[model samples]
Target: MALQVQIGKTELKVNPIGLGTNAVGGHNLFPILDEQAGRQLVQTGLANGINFLDTAFIYGPKHSEEIIGEVVKENGNRSDVVIATKAAHKMVGNEIVMDNSPAFLKESADEALQRLQTDYIDLFYIHFPDKDTPKYEAVGALQRLKEEGKIRAIGVSNFSIEQLREANIDGYVDVIQGEYNLLNRDAEIELFPYVMEHQISFIPYFPLASGVLTGKYDKNTNLAEKRGKFFQKELFEKNLEKVERIRKIANEKDIDIAHVVLAWYLTRDAIDVVIPGAKRADQVLNNLKTLDVQLTVDEIQEIDQIF
Candidate 1:
């Protein structure tokens, strides 16, 4: 049987692996973005049975959603795919701001709908929480939209444990997307327990740690071209050491290190899905190859200890 997972308690069932579209039409996030190539990335993933596509409004500041909308229109299979998009971050004048008020969120949803060229979205998320807005109030706005059939399910990303507790006060959230990878197991300490207890689906972003866990780099390798929190020399060396240990296991298993790292996430509790961004069609194909790699119980423990 093909792998299928029910997103939280909702009826929206999706493939375990998904495509995160930060690099798709995300001209602001990355340099050298080709609109046609972005469209092709979505097509390639869908062709390979990747039904879920995670995107955000701030990604390209609306560019990613526009490209995804183009692909869905051309493909003519809107019902066959699961689309998840988020809002809350917007540009006002020359500065970007986080606004979770009901009015702005509802406006964001309507704009997203028009941009996506769809009547309804599969999943909608509050991309981030503003300091002033009560967490539950922000969730309430999404709740209202869900009631109107504008979004199938509600999700929240980048929320703290306390913030999540407030957002899901009435148990309305269906999924939670956060950064969780082999290099960063911080989610396990608190977030996982609550999501497990509430039976909420946990979809992890940056599952590869910006490719640090892919075994393609070592301590001496210079990643001057990359920009992120993981680029520091001390942190890079520590992660490189962990990657080497993971590489040894991957070599023994005769599997791609990226695939091994991704598959290992499924071994964790309450990790319903993982969305790793891809810039090229081949990268999407490579991510799909992760489904073919499986780790044994002992291997899972060993890999866990290595981190």
Candidate 2:
């Protein structure tokens, strides 16, 4: 079953367990997947009730969006699902440059539209903040997209609470995509509450903590290279204690560790979406099951104690 949430002004019913394509798009140190398999993964993810697919122009430098275009076009249910993508760090003269200017934002959205084979994007985000650019300039650009029907909603990822509040002053920032999970409660302190107060949707990236909170990796094993940013030796050891606590609760509930982790987020006040990247069909199936596993108020309180 798919889950629904109010994504700012737009009311969208998406799979609470979104399928992240970071792995399929060859965005990591791992071997790149075949284009066919990548497309198939999108199809299979949708078949398994995953409606939210997050991609960025930098995901394998646009190869991921291209593959999604192929599969979304092949499936022809283009309007039935939500297609979200991001752009801001454009490569210029072989150097990375942040271009949150109106012209570049418009250009980038148009390029994504062409690559995704869609006329209008359901959701779009500014990948990361460029300290150099004025935040309102980016917000104005997103507002323009909404007015022109290029994108339905606007959001940002890897943003701080101050940044989000600044962006939405001119208008409502539809979605706020930040790193949030059972292990990461930083968002809860400020970003999550702000979004809740303003009626903006919260899309938590790394909702699985790059798989550390998923309990798939332990002290002895390594994680996928896509997760290298979070797989620090010290961080890994620190996570072991949290992992054991999560696992103990999950074992008593007879649920998968990942499900337990996701359920905790679902109970959060303002979380509208959780975009966890997936590589296989079975993973997508497991993600969909999260919507059915309800965590009651008492269970939620118990889970909070471990965090």
C-alpha TM-scores of all predictions: 0.97, 0.92
lDDT by residue (19-43, candidate 2, tens digit) is 7887667654246566566677789
| Clash totals, every prediction | 0, 1
Best by lDDT: 1
lDDT of 1 by residue, 1-307 (tens): 3577877788888888899999998999887888788889999988888999999898898999998998988888899889999999978999999998889999999999999999999999999888888888888989989999999999999999999999999888888889898878899999999999998888998899888888877766776876888778889998888888888878887878998899999877788788888989999998888888878888899988888
Q: Estimate the TM-score for candidate 1.
A: 0.97
> Candidate 1, clashing residue pairs?
none
After superposition, the stretches of candidate 1 with alpha carbons farther than 4 Å from their true spots are none
Worst-scoring 10-residue span by lDDT in model 1: 1-10
lDDT of 2: 0.79
